[model samples]
Target chain A: MFNLIRRDFIIQKRQLVMYVLLILFFVLLGRQDPAFIFLLASIIIPVNTIAYDEKPETNILMNSLPYTRNEIIASRFLGTIVFIILATGVTSVLMYVFNRPFTTTDIAISSSLALFLLSLYLPMSYIIKPGYSAPTALISFLVLAGIVPPIVSYLGERLTSVTDFLLNLPVPIFYTSALLLGIVFYGTSWGVTTFIYRRKAF
Target chain B: MENVVEFNNVTKRFKDFSVKNIDLQIQRGFVHGFIGANGAGKSTTIKMMMNLLQPDAGEVKVFGMDYKTHEKAIKERIGFVYDANVFFENLNLKDIKRIVAPAYKHWDNTLFTQYVEQFELPLNKSIKNFSKGMQMKASLAIALSHHAELIIMDEPTAGLDPIFRRELLGVLQELMLDGNRTIFFSTHITTDLNRIADYIAFINRGQLVFNDSIHDITENYALVKGRTEFLDRDTEKAFVHINRLSTGFEALTENVSSVKRTFGDSVVVEHATLEDIMFHLKGGLQHV
Candidate 1:
């Protein structure tokens, strides 16, 4: 399973230099939040690797390996976590080097959001064509990010009863429940992707 | 002898095409050639064997274990080569070796190196830069080095020159010489199978036409050519596939004795090749 992860690195060797350059470029913009850089770096490699698998031949190559479809999906999920950790660690070191201000809260939020985003997108990528999935995910993420919060706040302003009920809840409970929901969603996405992949005809 | 692979009532359906009730058996220790035209169910069937595709009904078994239930175990012992390139094209041979070598428990680096040297494949050059033949040789090298008991190849020789195809077939024959390893090779090129395949399984329009020993198939089917006048209504019925030419009528038939009885000295009867058998099996719109 780690070999599957290693394969992604081998295939992405040429892109590693560009990724490093991006990290340096992001570092030069020292005022920019380190968490944002970490998030971007984490997603870039994995998303591109997934996009490269849009070719049916890559599916064939992966399926031809001795690993089960479940193992393959597990590797992808595990690889994402590893990438998130590495990206965060590297970015944290760079952030300290550049004297950029960031807290553990930023790391926690950025990493969790990356996982949540991946959980939402990776299954869609598996279900749909990679070429379509990557662009669709990006556009959808941008559109939702730009629109969802304002719409929610506007609805909250319009409906006091609904806003009051939500604002009354304890902060810790809300955070814990949201964390649990994210974990459940991520686990379910992994299961769904495995099921879809197992039945997929090469 | 134990059967290495078996498909019992396996069926796969697509929106427009389907392969149904495909029953096949491949015994151990022989070169089994799967012959079909393009778009036939040969690849589909092979995919099912590899568990790359799920069957709509029935089951596929490898090494007496269900393919789906024991996929890892089955795949570990089976080396597969696709008709098209399957490796990451941007990665070089060394990179591929690094990725693929660990997947198999019995992967032999010495054997892999020997094949790389034998095939004269450059280590550092990317697979995308290699020619089609070189790509196939690389695939074969990987497949062979794993010490896999069964080697499954789909159209592995489609792009190679005659010399390379022969050499590839020779390698397969050598693999089976020990009577412990087996090969399941799919191809549209029948002549390659004629030289090396012990058993021939022919599929057409998503159906198994015949699965028999090459010798038995050749013995059973014959090609007959005769003057047009000799192809009477009764004699025409005997031809499995018949073509009306300007000079004469040539037909293929399994009822060779009856055809001989009917035409006697008027027709020429000859043994059929795998290509001829496949041509005749299509039933119409194919000549020679």
Candidate 2:
């Protein structure tokens, strides 16, 4: 399974530079946005990586290998985790080198958000056909980004006191809750993707 | 006696066509030629035996183990090359060696390299840049280098030119020197099968017509061409398959010696080649 992941990684090694450049450009544009590079690494990279795989019909070749389907899926999931860890380390060094303003809280929040979002995205990408998946995922991201402002504005006035109470909670509780949510969502998505893989004919 | 590969009443359903209760067996040593028309479920059956596709109703066993439960065990001994190149198109032969070498415990990089040189495949060039024959040669090289006991190839002879085909057939003849090794394969070219295959498994319309030794299929069945009404009804029944034409009825029969005994010297009984036997068994054509 690790070998399979290594194969995917090596095949996509040429595209890694493009990803880094995209992140750097976005970071320059959205300097006000903390965790920009982490977002690019986690959410952007995993989905498009999967998209690249589907384009060449690599699944059939993967199927012909000795590995089982579940092993293949597990390898992808674990590979993403490995990539996230390595990318976060690299992005952290870059931010420090450039003297960018990013605290531990900001890193935790961004990484957790990317994890939650990408975890949900994976099962969708696997279950839906690739042609429809990319457009649909992009549209969903756009719609959510579009709606966030008004929802935050509306909730701010209506629940000012409640928001204050929740915001005043201990930092450890927040981190622990975020960690639990990431684990649960990722586990659920993994299960669903495994089901989809087993039922897939090709 | 354990066959290298066996499909015991396995059935699989596709969108448009279905394989119904396919029972196939290929023992060690001899090459088994799986012959069928296009979409006759030849590849489907092979895939089922390899456990690449699951059977809807029955079981498949490779090397005496249930394929699903012991797939790793089964795959360990079988080298498979499909009709298409199943490796990354942009990857080179060296990349393939790197990717696949770790999958098998007994992988021999030395032999693999030897094959690379022998087939004259460039080590560093992407497989996408290789010609069709070169790609097939690379596939064969990779399949053979693993020291597998059985090789299951689907249309391995399809796109090769006649000279290359003859070379491959000669290689297969040499591979059979290992008395314990076997090959079960499928191809549309009857001449290729005639050159090397010792056993023949014929399939038509998703049903297997018969499975037997090449000698048995050739010697037992005689192509009989004569007047339509000259033969009795039982003689017609004895034919494996017969098609009646405007001038006469064409037929193939298993009762060659018996028919000669019954008909005296008037009836014509001609020895059949593998092609003619397959043609008659599939459906004997009408005589002009």
Candidate 3:
């Protein structure tokens, strides 16, 4: 499985250099948006691979090889995580070198959030085709921002006393909670995608 | 029969076209020529047999194991190729080796080198720049270099020039020297099948029209060219396909002996070549 992920990652090696330029370009804006860069590329890079898969009509070739469809789909999921880890690692070094505003808490928070976003998107890709995944992703992104952000902000602002209490807890507790949430969403998404993929005739 | 591949009442549906019902069997140790016209559900059935697509209705088995249950193990021993260029456009042949080499633990780098040399494929050039024949060779090399028992190919030599097509078929013929090796190659090229296939299966519009050994088909099936009146209704029953010609009527059938007995002197019992057979099988259409 890791071999599959590694193969895909090697194919997408160009994206790495392209992403670094974007991160370095953004750094000149006077604020550390490595976290944002990390989040943005997490979705875009994987989708690009999926798009390339569609472009060359390579899925038929991949399907013929001695791998399960589930294994192939699972590789996409696992590959995204590997990319996220690499992106986060690169961004962390940049942040440390430039003495940026992204502290450890921000990195942890953004990383988990990116994983949740990836989980939500992974299944959409298989449910829909990759060619349409971009527009669908954009529409869904708007819907999420419309609904989730307000609800989250309301719970954070209106329930300030409780929120502040939890926020002020030892950072490890917050980190662990965030980590578990990310894992649950990822596992759930994997289950949903695998189910859909197995049942898909093509 | 120890068949390498079998399908039982399989059905697959696409929005515009669907394979209605399929029952197929290919025995181990002989090359089975899967002959079908374009869009005739040949690739679909092959895909199902290999578990590239799941059957909507029935079962597919390879090497005595259910395709669904033993997909990974089955895949490990089977190699497949499509007419389309499967490698990444940017990568050269060398890069493909680096990536796909690990997928099969039994993959032989030495054998790969031999195929490359035999096919005269370039080692350093990117595949995007390759001619259609070169691309086909590269894909075939990858498929053959893996230590696989069965090789499944879809339209492998459909569009290549006669020279390249023969070259490709020559390699397959050489591979068949090892009697343990088997192949199920699909193509519309009847001449190619005539040259190499031990058995031939003709599929038309998702239905298996005929499945038998190549020799049996060529000898048993006859194209009787005569008048409609020369052959009565009884004589026409065994004809799989018949059409009225200006001279008379031409019919295709497998029971050449019965046809001969019925109309001994009046009808010409021409031994149908694979081309003549597939022509009638595909509604007797004229094809290159």
| Predicted structure with the largest lDDT when compared to the true one | 1
lDDT of 1 by residue, B234-285 (tens): 7688889888889887789987888878888778999988778787788755
Fnat per candidate: 0.89, 0.28, 0.57
* Residue A28's lDDT in candidate 3: 56
TM-score of chain A of each: 0.84, 0.89, 0.84
Model 3 has how many clashing residue pairs?
A: 0
Model 3 chain B: which ten-residue window has the lowest total lDDT? B279-288
The best candidate by DockQ is: 1
Error of model 3, residue B103, in angstroms: 0.7
Chain B alone, candidate 2, TM-score of: 0.93
Q: Can you tell me which runs of candidate 2 are displaced by over 4 Å?
A: A30-32, A52-57, A130-132, A148-162, B262-264, B284-288
- Residue B119 of model 3: what lDDT? 87
lDDT of candidate model 2 versus the reference: 0.78
What candidate 3 gets wrong by more than 4 Å, as runs, is: A32-34, A41-44, A53-56, A138-155, A168-170, B284-288
